[model samples]
Target: MSAKTIMIQGTASHVGKSVLVAALCRIFKQDGYRVAPFKSQNMALNSFVTRDGGEMGRAQVVQAEAAGLEPSVDMNPILLKPTGHASSQVVVLGKPVGNLSAMGYHTDYAPKALAIIEGALNRLLAANDMVVIEGAGSPAEVNLQEHEIVNMRIARMAQAPVLLVADIDKGGALASVVGTLELIAPDDRARVRGIIINKFRGDISLFQPAVKFLEEKTGKPVIGVVPYFQGFRVQEEDTIPEDRSRAELVEEQGWVDIAVVNLPHISNFTDFDPLEDEPDVRLRYVSKGSNLDEPDLIILPGSKNTIGDLAFLNRSGLAAQIVEFYRRGTPVIGICGGFQMLGRELNDPLHTESEIPRLDGLGLLDTSTTFAPEKITTQVEAEVAGSGLFLCETSDNRINGYEIHMGRTELAPDVRPAFTILVRSGEKVFFPDGAVSPDGLVFGTYIHGIFDSDSFRRRLINTLRRRKGLEPLQASDTLLVHEQRERDFDKLAAVVRSSLAMEKIYGLLGMEGPICHG
Candidate 1:
């Protein structure tokens, strides 16, 4: 049988494009079809490690989950991680090779990117019954459309049928549907087989007239309309713009509010996810123009471009605000890039020409960070260095995490000591490489994912609660909530699998008949 591919192009980003593609992958997989999820390229810091030690966007990982398969680097060939507007760290099949500007990638590497896309597609075709491809941001971003490697070109190369997805929740999604069709080249427009309206809230039937009008105008079928599912916890793809209405922030049960400095190009912002699951702790992402509002703790998060973000923080006046927060006895914590920013100065002479012209840091920690060419990437297990912030009264707990950064920090004089660098990389290498300040108020390390441990989370929340005069949370309740959410996500999959037209979906995906349910 010939390979039949389905491409899901979004009218805009964060529409239910990823989820819809995932649902389709699951539906076909249950019908006894081997399916794979493909994205020609992705720009996200929310990434996942494949079994082969390669990394790709986490959205692909979730889609792989829906298909009951493990994630592989081949599923996403090109990954563009924006370190700054002018430059991005480019990864080919999950390895950081070099950095390039957006224009440089488009002009110099478009042909090569095409080859990579084709190579990934060829493998998918040979191995799977169908390949479901997810597209990037808006299809109509005119400035970014030329020599495109992701959405349209990949579709054309694979000779796949396209299903345009619009986020009806974003409002004017109908307009997005029409606008996308109008913007594409005539030949490209012909490839669209249908459209899917996704993430509609309340009474989907209310939009029947709007749906009919769009179908009549574009002459493409509306395959399905998916409603919003609340409890589904698909891994996020990027730093979803920090909004006030985030559930994690509002529903936080932690008595202490932890403020994270939102940098311009925040890396691995999802480091806060495990912490979000704790009912007691509220994680606040504080960006420029936002007030500190007296947070119990101030955390400096990782940054893709540290020096650039430092300058941005200074420009936004948040840097001064942070200094003030430190003076006011607020506990300050820095992680990775945030840790670098807490130093007296950051030296990047290799990339920048300036020397000795120090960018003022928070000065909470007596340290200086020097940026180097090399990046560190690997999983690590560590014991609490000295007494960590959360478990000051208690002893070390096993912390499993990873490190991804480029810098060396040397502690300055007169700062209180926090963690003593203990075992690293399976060796008893202690106190030589990394350390926290003495007071424990200013703490940091190059480690990312430092809070993946459930014990660490509970201790942090319990510490915050005790400080705020609140009772400790029951462990059973938290476990029950997460279990219920997973059950809900499973039901969500069943809903999508049963609602869409099965025969047509199987035919579109080049799959045999569905198995008998009875």
Candidate 2:
């Protein structure tokens, strides 16, 4: 039998579609159903490498974790990582096809992409007991409706009942719901089963008349009014609001201050989530060179366009600040594209990332990088190569992270290797990964999740504290990072269950009542 399916589409982008899908996935899995999440197309720089070496959006990875399943490329079939303002690098089935302009993708590639989407959807439906589908942006883009492959098109293909979600925190929640329903075609509008008011801040009791007005006007029930939740943690998918003012650089005071140089096309900023969880760390993203304050550490994050972002660093004067920080004995670390930028030179012979043939780097590491056509996407396990560094207390320390980059870095003869990767893509391998300067003040690596390990994080922080003549801190008593993630899933599921009308939702899925409160 085909699996039951439900689609959640937002009235606008960042309307809580990803979080709601994750909540439902957790709820269903707790109730003893094999659930999976699917998104036909995703456009973001945040991505993940599956166990089988396939690449997909990180949001689906979070949802898959909530569902107690391994992430699969079929969960996110098409990924569009923007390389330029007008063009994007398209990945179909976990590999890069090529870069295409927006017009070219819509005009020439939409049909083929639609076919790929349907094939993946069918396979997912056959395997799972239930599938929670999330839509991108909005379905009310009437101008792009004919070429739409993500929203209403997938809903019709799966025959899934739709729950339109609107953020009440943003004003015009009622108008957005009414406007979206009015814009879609009559038949497409009929598929919407109910409306969910998400991210509500004020007292819900005061909103009863508003909910009643919406129901009377649109003839659809307000199925839920989810309050604004602050502590719930989930991997966000390129939805960070741009209007919020950038944080000001502040004194460390009692905590270790960390500054991450915000690149032009910053990818995988979620790499710093673990640091945010640490109580003694104050992490901030600084975009301007003048904003670089004296901090315990400075990190150069991954970027979608390395050469372009490197040029941005040069033009914005942030490169000079980074060099000054290194000269002053402050620890500076780089990952992936950031690792490439820390080297002596970056060469793009075939214009893989940019038209620039060669560009000078920050000159912090004795290494050079060259862009290649093939991108590496794999999981890895590595051991610290030596002691007396930020990431390792002993040479036996093991760290796990994933590699996602297109450049091949070559180290100088005199530089010391940082970590020796023992496994790649679930296979045994022995190879050096990164470089460390002689002074131990600068390093660069391709690993993304190196800080998630408690032992490594504690050692690094305590080492910095000792440098400042401060006492060492106690190791975290909280759960391990992965276990904390599981608990967070349960917390989100509880909030969703209490707020949403599950009886109506189950009825729409053709399931009988006495819904399991999992």
Candidate 3:
């Protein structure tokens, strides 16, 4: 039997489509169905590396985890990481195709891209009992609809029932939903089986009349009214929430204050989520021109455009501030692009990433980086080669993380290696991964998620605390990152099951009776 498919398209960006897909994936998995999530294309700076050395959008990775499955590049066939305001680095099936502008991508690439999208979708359908598809932006984007492979086109290809989701918290939920349905082509509009009013704040009971009115006017069932859920952490696709301000960090008042230099085109910001979860650590993303506030530890995060963002740091004077902080004996760490920025120079002779031929780095680390044509997207296992300020007290020196970068970093002969890479993509290997200063005050690594290990995070936080003349705090018994996400998946599934009309959804999918086991 062919697998059943359902597509979730949003009225606009960040209308909670990704979260809803994740919730449904968990719900289906709990109901004894082998489920998977798929997106034809995703445009986001945030990304994840699959176990097979493939890179995809972080949202699909979260949804895959929700479905109790490993992430795969097929889940998100095309990922566009924006390098500038108008240009993006396009990845097809986990490999960099080339940088392209919006017109170039749509006019020259969309047709071929659609074939790959369908191929991936078909493969997932063949393997899973159900596949949940999440569309980008809106099908109502009439200007882009002609070449839209992610929304109605995929809906038509799979003949999947569509759920149009609108964020009620942003207001105009009814009009947005109705307007979207009305704007799309009639055949595509007919594919929408239901409407989901998402992010509804205040009393949900008060929204019953509005739901009724919507269903009455559109002849589509208001399948769900999802309340604005808080404290449910999931990996966002592109941008960080604006409400995550420095004020909140100050109020939280953890023992150690860590500032992340948020670059203009920051990628994989979720790399620091584990640190944010630590009770003794206060993590804040300090943008260009923002005050660093004398942070005990400063982090230069991964960026989509390393050279461009490095210039940004220089132009914004954040680079100078970082140097001053390092000189003052405060710990500074760099990851991926940030690691490249910490080196003596960044050379892009082939213009692999940007037009910049060569750019001087902050010179914090005795290393240089050269942009390479082949992008590295692989999982890695490494052990601390030498004890640094952060790794000094870590009980388990072994770390598990992934690498996704476009440059190869070479350290000066006299520089100390930070971590020795043991395995790449599940195979054993031997190589140094990062550089550490003689004083252990500055560190740079190509590895993302280096702080995910609980022992590592705890040790780093406590070490900073000790430097501030504070006693060490007890280690947290909290769940690991993966385990916590599994629990979050269940929590989200439970809420969605209660909020949504499951019977109606099953009816739309042409399934009957309860599939849940317990």
Between prediction 1 and prediction 2, which has the larger TM-score?
A: 2
Q: Relative to the unseen true structure, what is the C-alpha lDDT of residue 398 in candidate 1, on a scale of 0 to 100?
A: 66
Model 2 regions lying over 4 Å from their true place: 240-253, 386-388, 393-396, 513-518
User: How big is the positional error of residue 77 in model 2, measured in Å on the Cα after superposition?
Assistant: 0.6
Each prediction's RMSD over C-alphas, in Å, is 3.8, 2.5, 2.0
Looking at candidate 1, what is the lDDT of residue 428? Answer: 63
Tens digits of per-residue lDDT for model 1, 3-26: 578898989888877777777777
Clashes of 1: 11
Best prediction by TM-score = 3
Better of 2 and 3 by TM-score: 3
lDDT of 2 by residue, 307-381 (tens): 999999999988998898788888998989999999999999999988789999999898999999999999999
Weakest lDDT window of 10 consecutive positions for candidate 3: 243-252
Whole-model alpha-carbon lDDT for candidate 1: 0.73
lDDT of each: 0.73, 0.87, 0.87
Give the residue spans of candidate 3 off by over 4 A: 243-254, 393-395, 477-479
- Cα displacement (angstroms), candidate 2, residue 300, comes to 0.5
